[model samples]
Target: MSLAAQDAAKIPEEIEWTWEVRPAHADAKLPNVLLLGDSITRNYFPEVTQDLTGVANVYLMASSTCVGDPRIEHQIAEFATMEGVRFQVVHFNNGMHGWGYSEAQYKAAFPAFMRTVRALTLESSTLIWASTTPVRIDKEVGPTNARVDERNKIALALITSAKISLDDQHALMMEHRDLYKDDIHFNDAGSKIQGDQAAAQIRAALSMNRLPKAQAR
Candidate 1:
């Protein structure tokens, strides 16, 4: 093979992306909430932080990789081990970026992913599972609605079986489809709506966390 061809072949087929946002002064007195997901979460993160300003200290652990990806475990572990931090609620979603994998593969990996996440958190922490947002039909950058629907069904099943709280971001986006800026992402208005919903869920989870064991029971 030619040198250029060999060099091209050396390139990896998969690339892993990760990022985090830790507040400089995360109030120890208030509840800590972790938001985990992909670009959609990144886009709306500011609004979520703002909306939850005094209510809770929100941290973001997001990446372009899917929950099924091994790297995600590392990311979760890193966040879980943050010094003197205990999350009161964790809101997580993953489905948009694993387009290369079939629905079955996605389904098969979900339980393990949830297990890893659960193992890393405090037992008392509320685990809220956010459904993947809607995808518009696009031949390029494709994640057709059909594919998203399939993955969401699998996620719903896993979440239901585990008895986690559902944030239902999918239904919210579907109701405001016109606010989408493209096939995958939302515009400013749409992001605020998503942020509001996320903040609301986080607040509810934190409030529940404060209840007496008997009342919560």
Candidate 2:
């Protein structure tokens, strides 16, 4: 079996889950955008959809699955094909979960993450890599920003080398620790801040410096 399969077989996480959202009655006239990340992404998703209202149909594929598990790649494929929509922009991230996997294992599996996302994008599809947010609580059992930072460094090197734009959410959140509603997730207000920034980035990517909002589908 492949290394990722081995890790999955030995998976240590107490629970595994995935959440997906595609705009209902999507506007074919507008371009599709996808936000792929974790629960943190989910928290900010509504605000992003609202911010980009009438501008784009925002879709979300947030999961507890981390980079080391091979399922992450398969799940991404499933989400893409299941929607059958060509995303104009995909803002993707991982590195918050799967603490059971070592950084070395993460590094080893990083290429699959890159390749999987790339395969799903079109020639015109814009890709943005968002750095994972910091872990605020000093938990003996969960994630640490130190590890998050290290993983960011690992991803940054590869992503920049691939010439993908970065959303830099890690740096953004570092300035707003006061917004943390929990150890890892942000409050609604804080999540709105993140969503606004994401909308702004996607706007810039779409070259919509000034665009009218359309009623959401």
Which candidate number would show the highest TM-score if scored against the true structure? 2
lDDT, candidate 2, 1-217, per-residue tens: 6765555553558988999998987898888899999999999999999998998999999999888887888899998889887778888899999988888788888888988888766766778899999988857867987899899999999898888889999999999999999899999988998999988999887764234445211
As for candidate 2, its clashing pairs are: 54-214
Residue lDDT tens for model 1, 1-217: 5433332222212666777898889887888888889889988889999999998888898887675455567667776776447678888889888666567667767888898778756778999998999876644545878888899899999899999999999999999989989878999999999999998988988888899988887
Native-referenced Cα lDDT, model 2? 0.86
What are the lDDT scores of the predictions, listed in order?
0.81, 0.86
For model 1, the stretches where C-alpha displacement exceeds 4 angstroms are 1-15, 82-84
